[model samples]
Target chain A: MQKTLKSLSNKDPQNIILIGNPNTGKTTLFNSLTGLNQKVGNFPGVTVDKKTGNFNYKETKINVVDLPGTYSLSPNSEDERIAKSYLEETNQNDIIVVVADATNLKRNLLLFTQIVDLGKQVILVLNMMDLLQKNTQEIDFKKLSKKLNCPIIPINARLDKGVEKLKEAVFSYQQKENIFLDSDSSSSSIDETMKRVGKINTIVDDCLTKDGEDKSYLFTKKIDNIVTHKIYGYLIFLGILFFIFQAIFSWASYPMDLIDSGFGFLCDFVSNILPKGILNDLIVNGILAGLGGIVIFVPQIAILFAFITILEDTGYMSRVSFLMDRILRQFGLNGKSIIPIISSTACAIPAIMGARTISNYKERLITIMVAPLISCSARIPVYTILIALIVSEEETYGIFNLQGLLVMGLYLLGFVAAILSAWVMKLIIKSKQKSTFTLEMPIYRTPRWKNVGFEILSKVKIFLFDAGKIIIAISIVLWVLSSYAPGNKFEDISKKYTSETSQQQYSEQEISTLIASERLEHSYAGIIGKIIEPTIKPLGFDWKIGISLVTSFAAREVFVGTMATLYSVGDADNTMSIREKMMAAKNHETGEKLYTTATTLSLLIFYVFAMQCMATLAVVYRETNSIKWPIIQVVYMGALAYFSSLLVYSIFS
Target chain B: MGKSLNMTLDRLKENESGIIKQINDEDLAIQLLSMGFVIGEKIKVERIAPLKDPILITSGSSYISIRNADAKNIEIIV
Candidate 1:
């Protein structure tokens, strides 16, 4: 950490702090200023994202730290608290660039004036100047600059207009002593804030002139009338959700397939080029396989985040919160929790991170805890292979495809489980913070595609690097466990398979597969599976299923791959071959056919409820800043999965 | 009779407009004041949610959503 600070200071980049109210395009301005040269880090002791970047002007590089958007220095949430503390700790030389919405100058200046009273070097950049002009409202920024004793630059951040001038202003910033309110004027903070607003209102009225009436938000209000309508509002939200789901599952699969094959080719190339040995096996099967699993989810995550960003950028997200607040509050979730819950269907890593919008600590915690309960895209493969064991793909009941209906039923079960769990958590968790749904409803506008692109890039980067590290580490460990045997057991199996009688009885490919399966049965993971068989037998899962469950902790979808390995199925993708093998198998004691309806349905229920994804748990730990929450999540969800599967097995049998 | 005369923002019907009187809750008042909800400002209830708890209100060019629990804290003049 000290080394990083030294490297950062070595550049001698002048500090330019960016602060603003929400929906003021402060982040858009930061992106324009820094371009692609930015890094997201955590604040000193808090989990709120600290976005820092640098831009070069002429010969000097200027460092910019984009603080979280806040209404005033008096914070309402952890995010705002970080912004306030960071501002209070700023060096005298650092220039505070307050980005204000040009259309709503009165509220925006509340923050600007607060910073000005702090007596720091400050620059006020009026963003959304185009909207101001379109509304026929004029801000005499030149006069306002003199009146407020700060540099005022009008720039449209979306269009990147006058940004250079804003930079030039920052480059030559001069500190001034301007206080919006006297220190001892009011007894309470509310009175002080009101006094400040009164002062700002007078200053704003003197420097602003309007022609006719402000109509910029009139169009938005009209759209809101329909979008927020009692019946039409819900229908529209559902329609959009349907479209997004289709794009994630259907459209994202094309790119996902390309990535899958690309990784497969890479693995093949590496394995072929390197000589066969333990090192080669570790590289090909351990590291590369783990990496391949992670990269495959990128397309789906990117698609989900892109749609979420667009929805948020166009200001539809706040309206969604307004519509969902009352209903979700009963579950101890805020309306902002809806985005994270919906995003959970694609992947919970991004969804857990998306819960940052919920300011209330309890609500955000519950949202994160229950998000993984929703069926994600990763569960699809497991559900498909398992469901196919009982019902064929073409089988249907009446008009609906039976297999498809089961998949839908599993998804609905997951949703119900998530909501119910959240309700339970709401009752148990204690919090003193007052829950409030005070959110700004920004006017609807075209999404800034550039910002959306940047958002996807950053979210994917966090998933790939932050969560990716843990996933890869866990994958290598699982590989070692399943690849190596306790002692000479692996050697003994290979030698037996190479004997003349065995070679004659089986073809070369069949012999190798038999050796592989036998070796796996004696391997550490397989032994662990055996040890847990008694515990899981009531749920209708045998030792082989136990092995898959052990491996599935790396990721739920690994159940399919592990099943193929244990069954000696050469092609893991050949679900038919594996299903046939599983169908023909028998219980060693009872001599009854395995893969019965009871076992299959029980396994399906298990996969739906298990907290088996390490990547998601790692993210939950980071987001909650506690190992305790993720531990509680695993314990509760595991118990739920166990009992639910047990109940299903009894009913089916 | 006196209780009926003391109007709160939450009691205002959809499309009804009210002038800011005082916010009983100190924290909510500070938050509202920063969001341009001054004591003398005119706030209009643009829409009430279908569930009728959180309502959308616009004061000047600033629009926001607040729950009825919070709206009950703000005294207003119809």
Candidate 2:
């Protein structure tokens, strides 16, 4: 950490702070100033978003810390506290930049004035200058600069206009003598809310002039009337949600198919190109397949986050929270919890991190706890096969396919279970965390596509680095466990099969498969599978199914590959599939059916509720800053999956 | 004025206008006040969510959602 920080900065780059009120185009300005040259991380202990970047200004290096956008200095949420504390403990040479919205000067200046009263050398950046002409509002820059006793620069951050001038002001501001306001910071308090509002209003009235009143928000109000309507609002919201879900599932499938085939082709190509050995087999069969498991889901993750950022950029996200507030509150979740819950459908790692926006800790915790209950894209693989076994492909009711309806039912069941679990956990989690659910509904506008794109790119990168790291590591460990055996029992099986090859009527291919299956049955993984066979027998699973269950802890989707491998050793054929193989298998003692309706349904229920993915547990630990929540999450979900499967299998049998 | 005269935020009718007199709840005081629920600020109930508990209020140029528990403490005027 120390080495990277030193290498990035040019020997202690000057600390230039970027602060602002929410919706002031601060993020756009930060992007304009730093571009893609930024390092994203968490502030020391708190998990609020912290972005720092290094840029060169006139041969001098400037290090800028982008504090989370806040309303005022008096802190409420953890995000607010980070910005407030940073300003309070500011270094002497640090230049504080306050980004303000030019059109909405009255409210934006509230924070600017508080910082000015702190007697710091501050620069006021009047952003969104492009909207001034549209709103017919004008700021008297000369008069406003004199009143505030600070350097003020007006620029439209989106278009990157006046950026060089702003940079010049930032660099040259240090050359000028420091100016301080007369009042000390002591008088600012919650008791003076009225006083502060009145003062800022007066300042706004004096230095700002406009021909029309509230004209900018008039269009916004018109849209809000319909979008925020009692009945139509919810209908539109659900409609949009359904649209997004369809896009995430259907559109992502194209890229997912390409990725899957690409990996399969690569593995086969490498196996043919390289000399056959254990290393070649490990790379071709184990490592490449494990990596393909995660790389395929990238398309779904990219689409889900792209939609999330687009909603945020267009200002529709806060309105969602506004609509969901009442219903979710009954489950002890905030309106903001909707984003995470929807995001969980794609993957839980990003969903848990997205909960950082929720100011209330308890609500965020509950959201994280119940998030994995939502059926993710990984579960779709498991659900599709199981549902296929239980239901027929040709069964359709006019327009809707019966099998597709069952898939939809599984999704709805996951969501209903998430909310219900949240309701139950709400009554249990005891925290002194204060509850506040106030959301600022920004006016609707065409999304800032550039900003949205950048945000999506960053979220995907974070998902890869945080969850992807754990996934790859666990997959490697699983590869080792499944590939090797403890003793020469594998050699004995190969020897026995080879000796019989010369004396028997079996072909070389048939002999090799027998040897493969025999060796796998005596491997360490097989012994472990046998150990858990009795425990899972009540759920109608055998030792082979137990192996898939154990290996899938690395990722839920690995269950498919595990099943394919286990089935292939005995009957590896291009014509017959893993499902067909499972269908052909029968118990030695009773010639009874396996993969029956009861067992398949039980397995589906198990995948729906079990916390099978290690990546999610790692993220939950990182987000909660404790292992206790993730541990409790695993236990309760495991217990739920177990008992529910037991009940469902019994009734079905 | 009969219904709106001494109503708290939770009791305010949909599309009603009021000036925030006080936010009596301690837990909600800082957040609401900072988000511009200050005394004498004119707030209009733009809409109420379904089930009539969480209501949207527009203060200045900002629209915010407040639950019944927090809204019950926000004393308002017609």
Candidate 3:
């Protein structure tokens, strides 16, 4: 027992926390230490990112947690509160590793001094020493260490220099007497801060030497001149956005096609090999089809995150925010909302999470509320098919496809709808909190490719796991609802179809197809679809389309699969696919053609304005920590979709 | 401390440096203070937005962008 207690006391993994001001290369340092061995979770009851990783240094295992970057311990934002709360939770085993940008030492030291004043065990890391060297600046590390009574290490985190020395410091650290800085004034916290700055300035003067002026700022300033120029700013920002959309669609198309067809082949193979039973049907239709819905979106999700992380890492997002603040503020959005709103085009789940950075509460709520209206990638399949049905392939002007242009116009309409909703919400929600525009503009630097790649992989993992779980569950439930019905309805359909197969001398494939379609039309899901048909009839939708709408509530892109199944049975000729079946659909009563330009346009508008995503609603609830907001979101978006679709259908039909 | 020495940060031109003397907005002052915008330190205007409302300033290598209204609350002396 005594030996076990001794081992437990001495061999427990040390909790080493990395804290620093933003843009100080702290994350880079954490990455180098832990590599891919990291656990990313949210802090308890909060959505703030908590990343912890394990690594073995010598004989000791250390749990290194990368705290969110903050300027001071006095928190002004949720991200900052997370950092402060975790730091205040300081156990005796906790050791703080504070990272400071060497090129900006005096300012970075302010946070370090505050941590030291709290008597925390800290090892100061001076990062960006390579940039310092380029500018011919030198620091007296030994003298500074003696004065601060802590080990000071200079390392270029990007290049992995001086990492070994940091490890040695962490292993050999011993508790020393806390030599507190002088309390020069009894006035206020402001005075205390002033005194700390005075101390940092003196230390900077004595231990630091600069031989030449830094020229990096000039380049940033020069770029800002054009990028933020009033007329040119908007144009350049639009150009960047155009290029981003182009890249997402073109570059990701190949992998997306591969994933789609791969899932199809797997489903077919499994169906053929497995015996005709409930399990076989469940595996092919329920599990594999549901999983395929998520896997196909992977390439698009990956490319979207890569673009965002690159923009963030290179310090260009802040510039875009700065340039957009004036326009966005008028529409009741914070400048930071642009990132989330634009990203929502790729997906709304992460877009809502991205709203955490907006400091103002009201602005954040507004951003989250309108974000999903931006028409995400799930709507792409719906739009592509609908647009093609309306506009023929020959209707292209030289290099531009008319159908592609229509899709672009739909994206723009989504943006317009989102902005308009934000405006209305601004008028409705009453709050006294004033919006503040105090953003930090980090110096421009080349993005770390490793970090960007890691970011994409991690975000993709979050989507694949979190949203993937909900989507798979919803689809499985949907499959069961569509497959079975009360009172032996499916059994009756199969028996009726079997007798017809024998009497008509139908082929084996034709018999199964007829049975499948007859069963689907009689299932509980089909009945629910018929029930909602009256509500959506004015929107120019039939019961078959109604079924697609019901199934796609789990995810918008399911409309395609739902339609494919509904149409496969409708097409007696057996040559037409989903798209062709949709094109050939005709009204039973009027004998007029369905899928007219007006009806297709109405469907597009409805999708653009509707909150038809279950994952987004759940995420919104999780993020806001309130059921009220998400309910309100659904009701409002649904009303918007209904009214807009009605108006379009009325005008065009 | 002279009355004539009181000049809000918004009045400071590009590349002009000042020492903060006081701040009119209490909340803004506390936030700016903790972020190295203390009364004694020097701050220099680095850049201005194209519309000229939000401007970037540097206080000891830490750059911050604040709107003109917020900047106007910070009283300084050139």
Candidate 4:
């Protein structure tokens, strides 16, 4: 007991909390210190990411927590609130490392001085030293360090320089009694901040010397001349958006195909190795199929995230936000909502998470609520199969494929619906918080590729694990609901199909297939479908379509898998076979073809508008931190889908 | 503090420079100050967005964009 207690005490001062202003390269320093040893979690009672990592120095493990960047100790946003609260809770054993951009020391030091005045043990790290050197500027760090009563270290975080010195400083950090502003002398928070700024300006001027004017912003301003030009800016923004869409749809398809086939091969292997039983079916059909559906979207998501990270790292996203803020704010969304709105095309889960940057409560909530209305990549499979039902691949209107044109129209329809919903919500959901867009526009630079890689890895991990767990569990439940019946109905179907006369009338393969389809009709899922058939009948959907709708509620792409089972189609990948089977299906009462143009188009419209993605709802619940929002989302979106599909069915029929 | 002596930042043309006299809103003042926009400091209008609502401005080494409504709260001397 004594030895353990001694060891525990020796491990004291193991934590180093990193804080800084926006665009200060603080994250780069954290990456250099932790180097993939990091994990992102949520702060207690909130969804803000709490990134904590550990690194070893001299055989001792030092843990680091990278806090969100904020302009001051006063909180203006959720991120800043969490950062400030976390800082206030730190004990004496924890040392605060304030990373400041050397090129912009005047603004960066405001955060550092605030932390130092908090009476916490702190070390000042001056990052971006290389940029300062390029401008022929010099900082008398020793004098600055003495005046501030803090140990200051200069290093280029991007190149991993001076990281060792930073770690060394963390080990030897001593608490200093310092205060930049006397709080009691100020009449308000604003007055205190102004006084602090006045003091910092003097200190910065005394220690820093410049040989010439900084040329960094000169180049940035030159590029901005064209990039932010009135006509050219809007055109360039659209061009880049079009390019991103093309990349997502075309480039991502190759990897998506690979993942699809790979999962198929794995399913086959598992089925062959295991004995034909409930367990084998569950593994191959239920669990593996569900896993594949989620993983198949990885390529599209990664590509989208890569592009977004590059844009942000190069400081272009802020420019885009500046250009878009005025227009978006008219619809109750902040400028930062542009990222999440566009991101919804690839997936809504990450898109919803991306709304964290909006800062304003009402705007962020509206962005989250309406984001799922935009079509995502998971809708691609359903659209392809359904569009092919009415329009052939060979059919074209001039140069555009008819099927492709219809898909684009569906995408456009989704965008219009989303914008309209946001506008309506803006009028309904009331808030007292004022909306402001005071965004920093960092100077452009080449993206840190390593940081981009880390971002992709972390986001993909969250999607695959956090959302994947719920998807797999729901799929298993759906499988059991569809595979089993109330009585010995499944056995009865099998037994009748095994009769000698039946065998003679139909081939062995035909008999089995017939039994499979008949058995599904008697299953619990079929009963549920029949129960809801009357409600969906106005949408030109039959009981079979109802079954597909119910099953696909767990995931939009599962409509294909469920349809394959309903028709007893052996291969789910063979879209042509499914199309043929669906074409032959008939209305039980009228004896008319089931997949008419009206019904197919209605179904396509439903997929476009419906809240069919369970993962998105789950993410919405987590992000909003309230059951009310997700419930509201489901009801509103479902009503929209039903009414829209009803309208399309009427117009076409 | 006369109206004739002060001009709001929103009226400044692109590439124009001014000295900040006051920020009308207290919260906005704290925000701008912490972001390195102190009083008596020279601020330059970098660019007005394409739509002419939110404009980018630079003070010292800090550059940021604020909407026209927020910019109107900032009093400056040309």
Q: What is the C-alpha DockQ of each candidate?
A: 0.86, 0.57, 0.63, 0.84
lDDT of 3 by residue, A375-474 (tens): 7878877886687798875577576666656777888999998999999999998888878888888888999998988898898887778657766666
In model 4, the Cα lDDT at residue A509 comes to 71
Query: In terms of TM-score, how similar is model 3 to the real structure?
Result: 0.91
Cα lDDT, all candidates:
0.82, 0.76, 0.80, 0.82
- Chain A TM-scores for all candidates read 0.87, 0.87, 0.90, 0.89
Model 2 chain B: worst 10 consecutive residues (lDDT sum): B25-34
Write candidate 2's Cα lDDT for A298-358 as tens digits. 7777886788778878888788787787789789898889888877876787688778778
What TM-score quantifies how close candidate 1 is to the native fold?
A: 0.88
TM-score, chain A only, candidate 4, equals: 0.89
State the weakest 10-residue window (summed lDDT) of model 3 chain A.
Answer: A1-10
- Residue-by-residue lDDT tens digits, candidate 4, A264-376: 68877887898988788777767876677678778877876788788889988788888888888889898988788877876787789778877789999999999989888
Angstrom error at residue B17, model 4: 1.6
Task: Write the candidate numbers in order of decreasing DockQ.
Answer: 1, 4, 3, 2
Please give, for residues A1-653, the per-residue lDDT of candidate 1 as tens digits.
12344345435568999999998999999999999999997787656678999999988889999998999998877678778889988776778999999888989999888888787778889999888888888878888988888888899999999899998987776545567677875467877787778888888898886643778789999999999888999999988875665565556668877987787788778878988777777776667766766677778778878988899899997888888888899999998888788778767876887688677899999999999999886787687678878988567788656766677788779988999999999999999988988888999999999999999999888767865676566666766777888879988988898889998899987877667666766788778888999999999988878877987887776765556445532222222344566777666458798789999999999999999998888878888888999999999999999999999999999
TM-score of 2: 0.88
